[model samples]
Target: MKIHVWNAFASNNSGSYTIVGRFPSEELAAQVAAELSEVLAAHEQWFRSPTAPRSGEGSRRETPSPLRAFAQVHSLTQGESDWADQGELRAWSTGHQVFLHDPCTLSLPDSYEEFLRVRGGKVETRIRHAHADIVSLFELRGTLPKKTKAETVRALVEELHADDGPLVTLAPFNLQPAWREGSKPGEPVLTVGAVFHDRDLATGFTAVEGLARRHGLDVTVRVSEEQDSRDSLAWLRPSHPPLKRKMFDVWLLEAGYSPKEVARRLGELRHGRYVDVPGLLKALPDTVLKRLTLSRAEQAVRFLREGGANAELRPAE
Candidate 1:
């Protein structure tokens, strides 16, 4: 029996941690389900029951706190009957096995292929009444708000977006696919949520080199490192020779053109082989560059060839 655990949080809520996992053994799974209900009941007793006074000032402390028992699982085994004596059952006795799975459900799409494309995982979506709706369970941890269900859903979506803000710190770690081609096992790949500033980038580069790192996976960023520079270059390129050449080189690099390939392409272009800059530009689609002074027809041609224009070729029209 395999199981996966996820750590989740909600906005305006206290520590309402929910563990969602699956079991292959029906008997083991059933035992786990029963254990969960019992644990939850114990939690209610400790946290919600008005009759239950605070611990240490308590009436013999009859009901053991669920939170305390759950924390004890780290040191205790599931097969141990001591946990059952303490108000929760042992997990290992149920002949169950567990594995880690990603917790984010926001990446799931209606189609399995689309889900894989976005999330890099294989998962089956199913609906079961007996299964706890983890999000709803988390929401129920505290006092219910007066807002309607629709409003609550809206708020939850907003919270997910806010939590994802940290993903933007991964921008500089985004390496090209070619760099990941022959990666070896257990190589240090950058995790998705890593944050990178200019200082962090320098440190990360050094660290990666020192460790001989290969692949990077699931990088997310709110803003790209190249965006502002790309925009500025778009405006400056057609008016400045150095900027024009630099922009061209950036475009080539972004298009995944090697120096040899670029030289070959340029050679072809020089000999009137009609090397397709339009097609190349379309494939790469540098919007910042397209918006610059090179957008002018005559300037566009000159910028590609002679680096903007000589003063004599500057058209009056």
Candidate 2:
């Protein structure tokens, strides 16, 4: 029997810590377990509280809480040892080793095998050892929405099968939804790891923008200097003032600025108290001009005509 023992330290916030090692025989496995128990006991003693404060009144205090160390033992058998007394235990242990070491080994139990196949070769094996702290070991970094406990478990399985490395022990952390209004108690929170590609990041940004829009939040894409200059010149002309005002209103709405702020800024610009021509241009898309609020339709047309003329004036030279 090739037995393995893992000691996992788990915390409420930091997730889990794991110590894994292999043993050649049942006797070795027993020895390893005893060693592990001693290590944990010694660790506990190191964490024990002292009789008195070692430092001054302003000094930080270190105290031992519910945090403790625990260990798990797993055995791998080739022949008669495989015929275990308990079916689930036998199946879980066997599947765990095979899943960890051999990517090609695929004679898992029907239900779990089917689950893995459906998940596109992503499978995680979690052995419920005599100790409950060691939740599971993962070999992959899986991607899944942290919306439900079931989804989280599914993600763990996928990560274990997909990643190629030493097993990573995982226990639930502060998993909760980003938004909580519609979320139920004990509902898992969803967080996506950063996407590396620019295109993927842009797509994610767009999706988040849409969600914000749905929730009555303003979303804006900042304009470049050239665009700002061009937009401003267009707004200053007397042609499509209404359209320009409407566009400014939209810009302000997207920029997450309140109408009052827009009005105040425009007031400053008009009185020559602020050199905010570029800002004014940017604001035109979402703000209505104070003097010409009623004539927005006419103002917008004039702005469009002026913008067209400005576009033509820029020479190829």
Q: Top model by TM-score, which number?
A: 1
Best candidate, lDDT: 1
lDDT of 1 at 38: 62
For model 2 the local lDDT of residue 137 reads 11
lDDT of 1 by residue, 172-281 (tens): 21211011111234431221112233223323222322222111121111112232222312322222111111111122323333433443444332322234555644
lDDT of 2 at 37: 41
The runs of at least 3 residues in candidate 2 whose Cα sits more than 4 Å from the true structure, single-residue gaps closed, are: 1-13, 51-317
List, residue by residue over 1-317, the lDDT tens digit for candidate 2: 99999999974332111122233333443343444345434534444446423333444335321112121121112221111111111111111121211111113223323322332332333321111122121111223344553444333323321212011111111110011111344322222221111112223333433333332333222111122212222322332111211111111233123434434443332322233545644654433322222233244334433333111111111
Any residue pairs clashing in model 1, and if so which? 3-98, 78-90, 78-91, 78-92, 168-221, 168-222
